[model samples]
Target: VITSENQLSFLNVTRSLEDLPVEQGNDAEGLLNECKEAMDHLYKADVYQSFDEPSLFIYRIDIRHNGSIHSQTGIVGLVPVEDTESVQILKHEEVRPERSDLMSRHLVAVGASSSPISLTYKNDEQLDKAITNCTSNEPVLMTEDSEMKQTIWKVVGETAKELSELVSNKILYITDGHHRMAAAEEALKKSNKNYGPLESTLAVLFPDDEMLVLPFHRRVGDPEGRSSQDLLKAISAVCEIEKSDETTPERIGEVGLYLDGQSHKIILPKSNGNNLVDQLDVARLQEHILAPIFGVVNPGTHKLIDYVPGPLGINVVKERCDKDSWLGFVMHPLKIKDLMDVAEAGELMPPKSSYLMPKPRSGVFVRDLNREKNIQ
Candidate 1:
């Protein structure tokens, strides 16, 4: 969509039409025209398909990485947007208001949700039994990509009802796509429509135990005129620094620092108190090291620091450090407990605190937000 206009240009048209530049024309008028064009193209291209009957399904994903295989199974359905305050849907991360607003506008323009908000819940045995019964036969839809294999089984009639009832009382945790959930809520509020599909969002629900979290690494650049030794001395004052044999972090509160062709391990202070959010290693790094020593109070927008997801591993951090950064910190990944605790306490995690493993592939399964019914 961001490339040449000659090939697969319809998506490009949609992107360009999305929230047009001020110099182009009026946003309201331009958006209406652009959406009309995009929707027409989408309908002709069969981008959105509808089912004759409303139904839920079992969505399964199996991913292989680094000689290991991880899998997640979930139910895909519509989650009520208004139930967030009722404790049915809980979010652990904070969303940027600007991003939320932009996505809200996108939802209004697109008119249908092409992606599902990923959600997690406490394990339910009844739900698992229902899924097992449904999967006894061949999958209704199965596909494979270069990285992962996906299998989906349609659950309709009484089976769907049973599965839905099994999970009706469970609380859902937001595993990914916090922004989309926020956008859905914003759209519902702004539209002044309290019922129907406008009041609900598409989501895929999985068990919390089956999900995986990977480390999110950070790279910090030395301040002007400061050397690698100066950075190390500053960090050493707060952490126990020692030469490390490996670049990967072994445990929580332990950070692997790569500087000037060498790697060192810094053991951070043990966290105390009942606040689980403050006890997080990322939080500790921010409180004791980044803000206090490196002057990066806001890591989310700080220019001196950069984040790399865990899939790229610690090597990327080292590579970046070798070029422009003075320090590369490889952190230990967070546990599911850590996430649940922080969420239960109504606290937010630090930026880039976690990278979910076996991420669900996009475009494999999509729900039409327009298919809303009385979802009591």
Candidate 2:
């Protein structure tokens, strides 16, 4: 577990690599070199341990939120890079090319991956029974903090073989780590060798029923310096609006807008489009409110628009608005079925549409690309 109480510690570590002098003119190469050096240092310090034989691991995370516990369990192993191109693995979100390129370079330079891509699949009775049996014994390692606890158990020999076979024929959905998967694909494409360690990347597969989906709220800055009343009047032309005491949205078609230290309820009209993606609440917010009112046509890269995770609570959004003079929108969480339907239909969701909680922690199961055996 990350011992540092500061939440930005991981970001700080990454930023140090990117904060190079402009005069260098080769910032990307310098960043990769720095990553290689860091990995080398960690290796020298013996921060990673290797298993004696091929095995799979059971990873479980319990997140405590608002007096309730949300638990999820999954199997940790390597997924073939080719699966990303086929129907075996599906992605719902579009990835930025620049970010994908940078990740590709990092993976090649370090020769290891600390983070595991998260995948979800339809629940199966046999797989559930297998996971339950594996987790019944004491965990090989356990770690915890105030908000969450993580445990891991190693499975080997025949049991590992059985678990791998059970999931082999099932189709998987990419719930998180879209960019990392893209990076792995890009790396393989650029490489000359057809089959090797680069053929697969690390991942953890969880059942769809146990996955937790949360809303990804939006925050926008008014570039025209419009007052809260003027903006509200513009929004009222397209949507039904009224002052509200609640800061969180109660339903799918409703949005809680915080502006000028007051909360307003925004009732969105039905989407005229026929696609499943257009019917989403985030899509409605972008189409009716963000684009028309704020002129933010592209929410993904717009300078005036930003995304906030729902688990951070509405107070964090309000505090940010109070400090920066920005407006916030609290959105309702999306259902798991909605996500699966959109993906199965071969459609893409809006950027930053969902925030999945209790993600697999980094550094828990490191994969050495050059030395590790291929899973496929």
Candidate 3:
């Protein structure tokens, strides 16, 4: 529960050692010291291995879950943040200041980073052929986790240059990790003492067509204490309501709603064709139902709402309502093209509107900020 009584804490242990410093202390100096302590531990354990030359890594990930399979092949390398215009990176979501500050402090303290900011671009035949040729051999390293299997191959010299050139000018869309990218930029501005490797952060680039996107469902509560019937009547004003046997939302412009013990479907009234952001299902739910009916001015910070990733399934939404009297609204995944369109137009999506599948693992490829050279 993300309620006040059991809120998620920023001071808890993190998913990787690189983030341990931020969890250890309250002040920036304390956090830096803790970060140094964590890195000292990593070095003492002799886990800080360095490659001899700058290299490009070909990484393959296969994810199997709930009778479904998802996979992708991409290259992991350092992304230079100094030339934002040249990089042509696009972001659809806005970054919060607190999260960006946390990321900046951690990077300055740890003096290294391995978490790759995921990016996607249009497919290129030459790049695909290069990756295929390199991955045809046995991987240099392979590992299996609960969610996915990761295989990596190292490519250097002229071959690395060839692969890098193929994607040198393409516009890269941020599929995930907006805060981390913002933090990288913030780290560059605030920590002038350490901008060498901080000038760039590690990233993984995949073909957009091959990436998987899943819905981010919402758990809405009646904080004002309205009855289910009253709420249903209120919702009928802006949407066409129909009782649905299906739990998950099947397509765009439609949402799956779970209230009490029954499932229902809600379709948006025709698009007014104004404000692309308003046409989004999540935005419509907020503008029409959450704001107008439920009085939730800001769903991102409201106590009456919670976001559930699609991987957890709608059954979890049903379970939450059964346990706590909260209503659930499951949104269909937004199309990638729509996301790109919003980004290109300099518009932001509603918070937690996307749940990208098969998230890349951390600590797979470390970039040492202390080193002057790039990853090799």
Candidate 4:
């Protein structure tokens, strides 16, 4: 946690999340760390992470694809984060503590988050119409997601009345940013006399009908770690390999591994592997291929292998691998049902495997966890 015992005031900073300023040269992890540092540097941060009830946040993700307009549902409220034997909140992704610890340290010190974890709940048709009636008039923040237009509005007054009434039966589930939520839990645990077991951090809540899930594509560096032959051999045990004298994977369950222009499809065999996790595409690549042939255990955290969200499609992957003949894997996006099932079962998906969007850009919404007491 960033120790705000220094110059920044932890509370009452700025408004209009976009006006915060410009940033560059940062991957997802780097950008979040930068936000933590910014809060500590510019705002009065706290020495300890005090316990504040998790509050609902009115969020919006405006997407403009072609001529169509899709406005995402956003909510504001306190979420429960506790280490109870029976966990109330469910999560789809697993959190790495070290990563979370870094975020917690930053958050506790500066008391600000760069982004809201994107989460969706079981679909409630009734709730959908009410939320729409409230948000249709105006929006809080209207921005762009890649080429899609994005916008959001805070729910208050009459609008809030509808939200407050609807959320009574709401059971929030986190779809992404598992690490960030874990860090909040960690920070609360290490706080002063003010620590509370259940406090909601700012999150974007949407019903099952309104939720969108995207698959994340995987790429590996040159065949240096594993010779092309060894890699093919390992993949062959699980998949049906079709040697391509050409380039790229052309179909589903087909992955293209290229070493300096030599491309092949690392397709899995008809027979499925045992164990749910091992059966996954990412798992097969790691266990049979990456570890045995390439010697890389956690490709998720690997610097050489980059991940691209499926929505961006394969063009970006082609651009990244063109120079060195990098290996690119195309995956079918995970179904929403699978994501929720895993989360409810308390299992974490492979890191970087799921990319849920449209991502809620930080600075668009500012949540002062430190000032939660005065909110009422």
The TM-score that candidate 1 achieves is: 0.90
Residue 15 shift from truth in candidate 4, angstroms: 18
lDDT ranking of the models: 2, 3, 1, 4
Question: What is the per-residue lDDT of model 4 for residues 52-116, given as tens digits with 9 covering 90 to 100?
Answer: 43323456656763367566666755455662224556775666676787667666655665566
Candidate 3 residue-wise lDDT, 207-289, digit = tens: 88778888889888887788989888889877899998897777888999899898899997655558777788888888778
Instruction: List TM-score per model, in order.
Output: 0.90, 0.92, 0.90, 0.73
Residue pairs in candidate 3 whose N, alpha carbon or C atoms collide under 3 angstroms = none
Q: Which candidate is the best by TM-score?
A: 2
- Alpha-carbon lDDT of model 3: 0.79
Where does the lowest 10-residue lDDT sum fall in candidate 2?
7-16
What Cα-based lDDT does every candidate model obtain? 0.78, 0.86, 0.79, 0.61
Alpha-carbon RMSD, each predicted model: 3.2, 3.1, 4.7, 7.3
Error of 3 at 64 (Å): 0.5
- Candidate 2: regions farther than 4 A off: 1-26, 193-195, 373-376
**Native-to-model Cα distance after best TM-score fit, residue 94 in candidate 3, in Å:** 0.7
Question: Which of candidates 3 and 4 reaches a greater lDDT?
Answer: 3
Per residue, candidate 2 scores C-alpha lDDT tens digits across 39-74 of: 666666675667868889999999986789999999
lDDT of model 4, residue 344: 66
Angstrom error of the Cα, residue 120, model 2: value is 0.6
- Model 2, position 62, has a per-residue lDDT of 97
